[model samples]
Target: METQRNTQSETKKSPQTQPHQENLKGTFAAVIIVGLIILLSWFGIFGLFLERA
Candidate 1:
C-alpha cells in the first residue's frame, strides 16, 4: 500500500511538464521557419544579381 501510493504521486508530477514541452516544440518550429525564410531571401537576392553581373 505504501509503495503504490508513492508510485501514484510520481505519475501525477509528470503530466505537469507535458504542456511546457509542447510549447517548446512550437517555438522551435517557428524559429526554424523564420530562419529558413531569411536564408532563402539572402540567397535569392544575391543569385539574381550575380547572374545579371
Candidate 2:
C-alpha cells in the first residue's frame, strides 16, 4: 500500500514538473475569426431590418 501511494504521488507530481508550453496561435486566430463572423452576421441582419423598415 505504501509503494502504491508513492507511485501515485510520483505520477501526480510528474506532470507538474514540466513547464506549460502551449501554442495558442491557432486558437487565437480561430477566436478572432468567429468573432468577426458573428459581428458581420449581426451587421448584415441589422442592415436588412433597416432596409425593410
Candidate 3:
C-alpha cells in the first residue's frame, strides 16, 4: 500500500517537468529562426555591394 502511494506521487511529478521542456523547445526554435534571418540579410547586403563593385 505504501509503495503504491509513493508511485502515485512520482507520477504527478512529470507534469511539472514538462512545461520547462516545452519552454526550452520554444526558445531554441526562436533563436534558430532569428539567426537564419540575420545570416540571410548579411549575405543579401554583401551580394548587392559586390554587384556595384
Candidate 4:
C-alpha cells in the first residue's frame, strides 16, 4: 500500500517536473503584423505631412 502511494505521487510529480512546450508561431506573426501596421500608418501620415509642406 505504501509503495503504491509512492508510485502514484511520483507519477503526479513527473508531469510538473517537465517543461511545457508551446507553439508561439501564431503569437509572433500577430506581433509582427501589428508592428507593421503601426509603422505603415506612421509613415503614411509622415508622407502626407511632407507632401502638404
Report the C-alpha lDDT of model 3 over 19-49, residue by residue, as the tens digit. Answer: 3434478888999999999999999999999
Off by over 4 Å in 3: 1-22
Give the Cα RMSD of candidate 3.
7.3
Candidate 2 clash pair list: none
- What tens digits encode model 1's per-residue C-alpha lDDT throughout 1-53? 99999998888784444444344788889999999999999999999999999
Q: List lDDT for all candidates, in order.
A: 0.88, 0.94, 0.88, 0.94
In order of appearance, the predictions have TM-scores of: 0.55, 0.64, 0.57, 0.64
Q: Evaluated with TM-score, which candidate comes out highest? A: 4
Residues 1-53, model 2: lDDT tens digits: 99999998888784446678999999999999999999999999999999999
Please give the RMSD to the true structure for each candidate, in Å: 6.8, 4.2, 7.3, 5.0
State each candidate's clash count. 0, 0, 0, 0
- lDDT (0-100) at residue 34 of candidate 4? 100
Which parts of model 4 are misplaced by more than 4 Å? 1-16
Residue-level lDDT tens digits of model 4 in 1-53: 99999998888784446678999999999999999999999999999999999
